[model samples]
Target: MDRDDETSSTPPAPAAPARASRSRQLRLAALLLLLVVVVAATVRVVVATGPPTWDELRERAGLTNRDRLIIGVKDDQPGVAQKLENGAFEGFDIDIAYMIAEDLGFDAPEVTLLSIESEDRARRQARDADGSFVTVDLVVASYSITEQRRDQGVTFSFPYLETEQSVLTLASDPRQVASLRDLERAKVCTLGTSTSEQRLREAGANPIGRNRISQCIQALYDGEVDAVTTDAAILAGFVGPRPPGELPPATKLLRPKELRHWDIGAESAEKWGVNTGPVPEMRDLVNLSLQQSAKGPDGDRWKAAFDRYLASEQQYSNPQQVAVGRQPEPEETVEVRQWPWERWALPSPGRPRSGVPSAARAPSRRNRRSSGC
Candidate 1:
């Protein structure tokens, strides 16, 4: 074969360095993808998990029976929940809070109520006054348990009370905008990032978002917004159906006369979600309380709380349209981890590890011994 023909027939071999570089690039790309997946999975798990266990939190705070649990509560909400003129907290939520604490072995006086605006309820389990990483042990501020909220790292106990979405407008408004549709280009006010805000957006209304329900109330009273919308029970608390504190402004609900139901926030009906941080065990305890609160010598804690606060609220439906009533204890018992320096049983003796490790796994150093010579 001629030299030219031989050269064309045997094409040049790719450079070794180039091949190695291409292989390294592929491996790096794979590693990057794997890292992204791992991080995303970790984030999802963390978001789903509740705050520290109740015992752990108690220990961290050096809490005792003498140490009152700082509970997050809404002060502006009237009969449903509010700080009274006498400086004591009142309402249905306040009663529920005391009941939960009582179930956890704390007396009513052993609990402390922290005034929380509706907007700050989501952050109930957050930093404390000392700039310490702490959150409220329980949140009872008309907080709802929704899939959207659950996705946002807010852990909720089972529902204790149910409410419906409704609208609130000035009693003297010329527009008389009552229903959701009544709000055309008219501005509506609500706590920012709330279910009510989302629903209003969906309902095609101009929303005047505020940081707190107090702000929303002020906006409604000032006519900056034509109406304020939220849970019917909340609306009931606002209007004089059942007053919370001194009436802020005269407000009335806009509802269809035929349908006693109005589902805002795409909520089937509003239900109270006792919020905690990533305290899974606390959640379990709270759920157990719900189960047994109506069963024992405590005289059915829930019924007691209902009689104390909810019974008088004129807005709640008759006998209540409850999705949950007198929850029964789980057939299986949960481990009562009452201390921080304790461990929970793993699903299997040798299972793959997950979640962010609290510490790095140390390599074992074996000591070698020489037999006698």
Candidate 2:
């Protein structure tokens, strides 16, 4: 073979540095693509697992749009829930409303208490101080949780208070009303659309429906009705304090001395719950607040409220029955999802964990802890 043919057959070698540079550039490009994919996947996972924001919680609880929380409460049901002369509400129900509102991130001033009648409770419509009708976020009135009420679109939290039917009559009246049967064929005044009215009908009493319990009380005083029937706690409020000096100004007109309290002695109890109206999401939030109140170390709101409003009235009411006014153990379980930072921020065992999804199934009656009321 000729030297020229041999030289043409062999290709010239490229520079080593140039070859190395091209190889390095390919590897670097692959690494950068891989890094981008990894970062994107990590960001997606974190977002999906992250804890809910405060605004999200309020939105889910159906209170995001409103700056203040409006609660429906009874203005006339004296120790259970009543309006004071200073235009403030003070009572057990009012205290309970405060507890729930605090848990919901509202201050005392951010809560608006509106007067709600028994019939309007299910509708969540309350009358403001100016007599305008406003929709309430919650009904902390002496609202009983019944299956029928649930069917009617009222979603309630777990029971907070358990009471039984009671009758209040004029002390001067000769009727000895120890049980429901004693009121048979007699005209009894009860709030319309109330559990007491149904019970009165079952006991063969003629129930006259009124807009408010106060109206029933007035009817009883005016000799228009034989007695006013409702929960014992409410009746005890009408009776006021046993001591003359301790008599609440609101009850002075009721003439506590002339009011007679009769324990109806029923087997089943009226389990009072916070009415959430049509919002089912509010149920768990309310249940958790109540659970904290009953069990948490930092949560003595329920006990304090009971002592302040209902404790002293036990003298005029049924001591045994009134003793059961203790706060109920929440029946439902609450689960919350939180970030590591959130857990570290709130280390107290009493603080409710936030953001975790709860169990969907309701606890069976057999598995539920009894409130002993």
Candidate 3:
């Protein structure tokens, strides 16, 4: 035992401070690790429960993985919905389908149009040229929204057009059909599964059910039916100026003079809605698109369609029979939650002006302009 042994025996000059420093380092490391874990968990939760994205919405509504957005539309109805010779679809309903498809992230080429008859509208089924039953993502076939139809499993979006039921006869026909009673005991052609049939039955008229409005018109042309009854907007379509040879020689005879307005109650006004099948998400998404179209900043797309397709015929039509000119308000409100960063997307607030109350500085309350059905 020499000096080295004596120094060792002294316990290395009190190492408590170094031991305490090491303990603090270990604790700090543990604290940092815990903070990182907490941060990671918080990020995971925010991402999981965050606001929905458009892609997420599309996926949830089952639009993803599909090659195209298949929309069911009438192959013929003149102004309301129709297929063109170029294998493309045109007319108001087709325009509406395009608008909805655009909002749903599909281009014109990405949309496949299949002809859908009135009876098959609620079932969300359409037919290709080959007559194969094709499933469609939406039906924009001048579908009228009704409680009975809703109960029957047809989920409707917001009503896009409002037109009253009316009767159309050949211009050569001299009979005045101002009311349903006028059609009593007469064979009136109407689309099957349409409100027109029920209404005709109510009026003690014989409703000749057809698969399409074109069929009804054809029946009238063939003298197999006395009159064709449906939404005035639809009748206006055929009455409007058509390309030469667009209609049958007989259907070309439908003139404004022969159109009769019932001028009935709310039950007679057909509020056309997009059939979104049974998916509530799809319904809500379509409703959102309609809401935007009806209330967007620039103007109403619905009005544009109406003006382009049905407005001209209004002068010849009974003023009361024309659809309520403006687009109807959406039935449901859509709440799109914003992401945390979206707050930054908005303009940043400046400092409050001197002596101005917060409420006074806020946007003034302005009554929304009145709109009809």
Candidate 4:
């Protein structure tokens, strides 16, 4: 009778623990299957995206950073790329920099200018007051495209403007020295490490080495140096009409009637071009913009820049004021605009030396010309 009663108790519902364990096992199996499915789906999505295609990479390459481009440039250059009093940059080279920024899909405000030296163009880096490093993305100074500079690991754009060497002499000087040959032993101011130095010395000039072009100008105005010599475009900036209290703009051009403006010779007819940060793609892009400026529509950008900033009697052209690689007589009348120097001046009127820079007056004409030849 006891046995029948126990069997009729439903065997304690097949043991409560056994029932619970079977339910937990079923849930665990389902979770594992779900996790595996999710992992497979994620891998498929990753495969679909892959790496960015060439087109996308090309777009990103133009951006120096998230939203702006840092360009290295010379600050004191008057006609090429002067850093203006308003903290804005102006000149033919400045215009070129802006155009390049635009072509790379950047706007005016999106570009940053770092004042650099002519020597520092190849290695683009500077230290801030806080001692951090600042690297330039592009360089648009009056940088000359030379084989030596090219070997420095920086790539240059196609020749956009051709610059020729020329001389600036006093208008009142009775000598009226017309050719390089006439400068026998006269103190001539020229930049060191430049071909102008050798050429001036060869021409029998007592070359006065100045670090920046502005110094040479100051020296000439102060009568410290008899003459200032450099690229014609550079000299033209000073020869235009001027207001009182400023350096006399009535300077004379003692150019030869040979083939070109470069007094140094065929090699001296150097092409002023843009420099890229060792970026092969950037070289291509810059060249394209340069080409468009010369070959594009009526309102060609480069032509417009030439009209506004570089124009006068000595305006720039694609082929240049004088023929490249040839010595020629300069035009009889060169009409350059003599705007006030202080009007849209550079951030640093003087080129940078070992330390900081702005224009400081030449050291009291340390070596004044005692006699003129």
Candidate 5:
């Protein structure tokens, strides 16, 4: 009869054990909430004072706030160099660089000219270790793309211009020299350490190397070398009619079938070129600038400058120019510090193929005399 009362009186000893387990679980939950709060606060602090990337500092420190951009250029061609004069820096390469800088917020960039020789470009770029010269952000020289250069840690951008290799020969020569094989019997001269020389060697031409293109041209003129082998662009500048007797009438530029294909592009690399370190972000930024310049106003401006210089050489009149592209518009205004061509006397148009030359001359009657030559 007392069994129910006895069970009730014993009470549940297991209840005390259950309450103790619940208390332990609650303590663990509170500890986990505290840890989560600490982690959130730490992340917020880190986000507020973000770590600076090497590229951000390098670009900001090197590039000033005043829209000043310094570019490297070769000092040889007057026409091309002239574009960089006056605030314009307007050559194809110069225009491209200026446009990139402008798009990056450096409008009216202050261009500081750096002289780069065809041979010494690699070495000069390698001079970053010594800190003797200011590191050039970009090089706008008429640089060619080559495989040997790729090994030197220089990266190349997409090609913006195409050119060919050709021989600038005496018009009097009757020999039908059209390919590198033809050069086996011909004495060929080229600038030392030039891509022309490299290509010739690759083709088994075995040409004599001169110090510069001017010297190579002179060697050809003196009969020391049968022909001057170089990029057609440079040869065009040399053979095109100059202010009267500057170039002889007998000098004729010939682009043989074999030595007729090269491309011009920007160069940079991981160690020696534009990319000196492991900063992919910087490389990307520079590449973007180059691409923008190639597409927009900068591209147009560069084409005009390139055309103006090339036109003076009369290179664009040939079939190759037609094959590649048309000349840039002449009416376009280009920026420059001074008009270098203003004082030079340009030859009056020879009788046009028809009456067009004469008609064109009529309009330039005052312009020719007023050119301040």
Candidate 6:
């Protein structure tokens, strides 16, 4: 090839394109760094502020904008309803709800009694997309806190009170059954949908399911059943020492196991207990209310109410009190002496050394001679 053709065929360097590509990459990196800084600043601001205050959270929940906060309460029971009538709703839970509403600048909440059957409670809560009911803001029933229900997308607050399963029997009966084993031969009755019935079955006791706890208690009282099983707290309320002349001479209550007690919390299922969904905000709100209620004046007031109504009834005389009787006097105390350490003495050829050092303590003659002391 000619020298001119060779010079023309040699490829020109692509330095300009390479320099432009490097410059573009640097610009992109700088832009990315700027975005990271902006995002970091925004996150810092949000974290520094933390979540909204309880009052702010309640207000943001839109409770204040509404004319009234309606709380749904199950109407099938007399305990909660009776307390409501006696101004207990005006007491702890209700008072807390009202305070939350008032802080948000809303009117005192009006409690709406809803007739939610024991079986349908899960369904009612699922219908509301927001935590608020289209007809009420929240449910204040004596709902039990359970993991199975929680999995159904229901939010529950910390427990307000602790209740347990108890066996209710007649006061005059000679057969004092302290456990399920003791009641193996006796007839046990419980409500159809009650946990007490299930517990009895688990304990190996044959339980006859009835419609309501009241019916079971009636059966026990009338001798139709040997014992009635129900929540201890409710039983305590029912058997509360009847006002003079109310209950006959033969009525007593006992609680054999205290560990069976369960805590009560406010709960609502999503899709009516059909599906699990987000309830973090609602759960937080209820938990906040429960925490607040558990402390301060509200807690004391409710405790007093519980003591007055339920605790008094649980004071019934236990048959075991008469059977086991007082504990026998403790065995007389006995004195003990610690063992002494064994005494040891080194053996000497004859008598023990007086002033002379033993052979084991003698210095080497070679060392002594070398020292020339």
By lDDT, the best candidate is 2
Ranking by TM-score: 2, 3, 4, 1, 5, 6
Candidate ranking under lDDT, highest first, comes to: 2, 3, 1, 4, 5, 6
Task: Indicate the worst ten consecutive residues by lDDT in candidate 5.
Answer: 364-373
Q: In order, what is each prediction's RMSD in angstroms?
A: 23.0, 9.9, 11.1, 16.4, 17.2, 29.2
Q: Each candidate's TM vs. the true structure?
A: 0.59, 0.76, 0.73, 0.61, 0.54, 0.52
What tens digits encode model 5's per-residue C-alpha lDDT throughout 69-106? 55565443323332222222223344444444444345
Model 3 lowest lDDT segment of ten: 364-373
In model 2, the Cα lDDT at residue 43 comes to 66
Q: Give candidate 6 regions above 4 Å deviation.
A: 1-49, 59-62, 72-109, 125-137, 242-278, 296-298, 317-373
Instruction: State the number of backbone clashes in model 2.
Output: 3
Number of the top TM-score candidate? 2
Q: Which residue segments of model 2 deviate by more than 4 Å?
A: 1-55, 62-66, 242-257, 347-373
The residue pairs that clash in candidate 1, if any, are 50-277, 50-278, 50-279, 51-277, 51-278, 51-279, 78-244, 79-244, 126-135
Q: Candidate 3: where are CA atoms >4 Å away? A: 1-51, 243-267, 340-373
Give model 4's TM-score versus the native structure: 0.61
In the range 1-373, model 4's lDDT, one tens digit per residue, is 6988878976445577888999999999999999999988975675465433222333546654458778887656555656544455556677778776665656676677777666667777643336565888888877767787777676877766776777766655555555666778899887765557777777888999876677776677667778877776665555443223322111222321111122333345756767777765566555545554554331266665665555642522223352232212221221112224522452111111132111221111111111110
Tens digits of per-residue lDDT for model 1 on 1-373? 9999998999687799999999999999999999999989976775457344445544543443445677887766655566544466556677677766655556665666777656567788434546554467778788877888889888888777776666666655555443576676779887776677777777789887876665666666665777777776655544433323332322232331211222333346677778865766667666655655544344355664455444444434332221233332343443333222233332111112232121221111111110000
Q: Cα lDDT of all candidates, in order?
A: 0.57, 0.72, 0.69, 0.57, 0.46, 0.42
After superposing all C-alphas onto the true structure, candidate 2 shows an RMSD in angstroms of: 9.9
Stretches of candidate 4 off by over 4 Å are 1-65, 126-133, 242-268, 297-299, 313-373
lDDT (tens digit, per residue) of candidate 3 on 1-373: 8999888788456888999999999999999999999999987886688645555666789988876889998767766665554455556787788777767767666778888777788788887868899889999988888999888887889898888887777778777776888889999988888888888898999988887777777667678888888887777655433333332221233312333334434354689999998877787678777877777532455676667666655655554456777888877667544455753563111111122122321122121110000
